[model samples]
Target: MTTSEHGAVPGLFTLVLHTHLPWLAHHGRWPVGEEWLYQSWSASYLPLVRVLRALAAENRTHLLTLGITPVVAAQLDDPYCLQGMHHWLANWQLRALEAATTRTASGPSPASAPEALRRFGSREHAEAERELVEFDAYWRHGASPVLRELIDGEVIELLGGPLAHPFQPLLHPRLREFALREGLADAGARFAHTPRGIWAPECAYAPGMETDYAAAGVGHFMVDGPSLHGDTALGRPVADSDVIAFGRDLQVSYRVWSPKSGYPGHPAYRDFHTYDHATGLKPARVTGRQVPSADKAPYDPDRADAAIDGHVADFVDTVRKRMRAESERIGRPAHVVAAFDTELFGHWWYEGPEWLARVLRALPAAGVRVGTLSDAVRGGYLGGRVDLPPSSWGSGKDWQVWAGERVADLVQLNNEVVDTALTTVDKALARAAAVGAPTPRNPVADQILRETLLTVSSDWPFMISKDSAADYARYRAHLHAHATREIAAAAAAGRQEQARRLAEGWNRADGLFGALDARRLPVA
Candidate 1:
């Protein structure tokens, strides 16, 4: 085995985190919508960014690849969301304080108010207070400047995707191409750095997308290990295109967290499903997978911290073994790319950010080379060319999760809405051209396109399929579809005044991509 001066292993390891969420602002709040945004911001985005910045302070470079979809980026930079998130953090602190103060008037009964819960509340209150202060000081301006700083500092590589997180394989080729270009342009405008790689929403791929990616100047993307027919140790060129497709190593990636098992399932970690209903706080530990939330053990930070250290060491060992075995099998240095949703870090797995920081720091000491996906490509870790099949990192490793029998209706709805919106915009453009009017500046057509794109988000179908929040997902999909239909109807009827009114109304709710113009809609 080859070794560095420190006698570390000789292999490449890349960590990729895909960040995305559909248009949620002005949609709903309590159970879903903007709440999802704020929770992720507080739990995942803020902490993960802090971790990277800390590493950067020590001159860590090419740490990992971060894919922030255009839609999510738009929300992060939005003034409305900025204000909403700040208020939400403040409220979170208040709720924690209330939880801490809850007590029985009759006596100091343990059942009335548990000591563990009070302690948890105190911890949460302090954390929220710190986060609130940080938000006002750094994030009041929006997430773009902060993210751009990381990119400029060489701490992370930004991976840009299409405007909305649509399943590209199922989308019309014209719309897919249009979304890809517009999405990259949006990222460029925000970060002043256009990304050459993307996370390929859901890691979904179909034939001929390589050509489209090449045309759009995309250099690399990701797919599941099965997409490469189980050989995913290195990046592979796809279908005669120079654009590289990096397959996520399920063995190593799942070692951190997976549906069946992972570090998060340990008994010491915080229980994700369980919560104290009265205070909206999770005070339970994952005592057992089969145990109900109420029956789980009270959470203890000391136990969780111990578990984090154990998992981090186990993860480092897992990576070392995989790298050595793969290198020997291939008779050269091999790369292992472990990709996960950014939300998994803190939102789903409370110890995720800490685990991430520890793993990134520990790997190098163990002789493993860690870098972003781009670094692997640049370092010549490209494997042989292979024809990738239609696949995703979802259940069944196929298109079933987003377009299966379970969500057939959503699939149909997406097709119908996209078709109607595109046709309406096309007809309006033709009429405007005939009448010597400005077609590109039509606000009604622009809103139609925006609402239509939002309707086609892959999150709706996945959510419905998983039954995590089926009702909310369905509501969001239909809500945007209704907006698209009404805007199109008004525009097609030549009711300019009515169309403008409807467009303005919808824009207040689903107005993410301010630069989204109907003129960018691809001709079909």
Candidate 2:
């Protein structure tokens, strides 16, 4: 085992943040589409990166492992998205100004015009100005440059994943392999740094995926704690494969946020659902669980700031205790990995970014070793080997959220589209080979594969099962599936001109990955 300067303190701590969203650009915008991207970019990505840059300036390296899925990275680098995000930020500032004017002209009492609205307006206006400066200075070129700076400086380890976030366990073998390789290639092209590890979509895995990962040059991946039978203090090699699987420590992770209870539920934090009808801003605090949103108290930044300190301390203590206890039990320096969606910071929980910053800074002072997942493996924190079953970080710790009875129809639709697309592409390739011609680099077939991959995204089924934006999720799935069918039909009928027109239309609408090639599919 490798030794640190502290000479075997309590244990190691690794934070993994998975960043992802479906191909939302050029789709819809309001209610659920590109708006999701802009909001997250403004609230989460910008502020979080600023925090990291601050920490890096202080010479703190290897702060966390960041997974930016290929599809989301595509959107971040898209010309259309950058322009739309700038416009969105400018509009946010205008809206804040309008809210301030409205409040000043007609001064209402505390009951009518809560203090939270005014405070929120001022805060948003200031933030918009600050973010606009950052965007013009750093992000106007796209997120790749910003991300590359961090990776190059050793401030963060980048984890990548498949082209679209497909549920790998259910995907056909050939398509799954193609997606994984292409996704890594896309990331390499964007960052100029091929990731040695990846955040498997949904942390979903089936037996024998290790061989594929190994072939793709992935050294490690993340899985849920239960997948390792609840002993998650150390990484474990998957059934004799050198590829390591790190289990997320739910104990330390759940301290920040969980389904039932967490720090975000504190009374002082901003309420996520309740919004001011006029200003479209969250103006109420989560005063009480049963309290109606209207009756909730106005959000006080001071109170929330105090809550953030408390939560940070609580999280640090929890990590320390878990690591110490696990180290003693295992008779070695153990590691605890706490993973979460990167958007949770500043997007869902307003105080999350502050909490994260404080926690990272405090952990090292509290004698906790802060490192990335790669550090854990290199430092010999991997445990014994075992065969991992099909698992996901979902409800019931299985594939219920994506492939359960509730989403059976979507599951069937996804399978049919995938099968049809694959067969059509394979037949086209064979026709070219049989005629003693060069293999066809068919753009139509490539677009069909792209549509098929988008249709199988885990988001649709998860949203439908959870009853959150079920209609939008269904619309996206069916829309992509229909596109795949149309393109495949045109190709099958030998209508080259029609196929080219249809493909170009779809390409303009749903295009993200320009490097995607249909020739990657295995021979039929």
RMSD of each: 2.4, 2.7
Highest-scoring model, lDDT: 2
Q: Give the per-residue lDDT of model 2 (tens digit) for 1-524.
A: 12343234576899999999888988898899999999999989998999999999999999999999999999999999999999999998887766555544222223126344666678778888999999999999899999999999999999999988999999998999999999999999999999999999999999999999999999999999999998998898898699999999999889887899999899999888776666666667888888786576777889999999898878877887898899999999899999999999988998888888998898887778999999998899988997998999999989999999999999899889999999999987778779896776888888999999999998999999999989999999999999999999999999978988999999998887889989888665
lDDT of 1 at 90: 91
Instruction: Please give the clash total of every predicted structure, in order.
Output: 1, 0
Name every residue pair that clashes in candidate 2. Answer: none
lDDT of 1 by residue, 299-404 (tens): 8899999999999889888999999899999988999988899999999999999999988898887889999888988899988888888888889999999999
**How many residue pairs in model 2 have overlapping backbones?**
0
How high a TM-score does candidate 1 get? 0.96
Cα distance off (Å), candidate 2, residue 57: 0.7
In terms of lDDT, the poorest run of 10 residues in model 2 is: 103-112
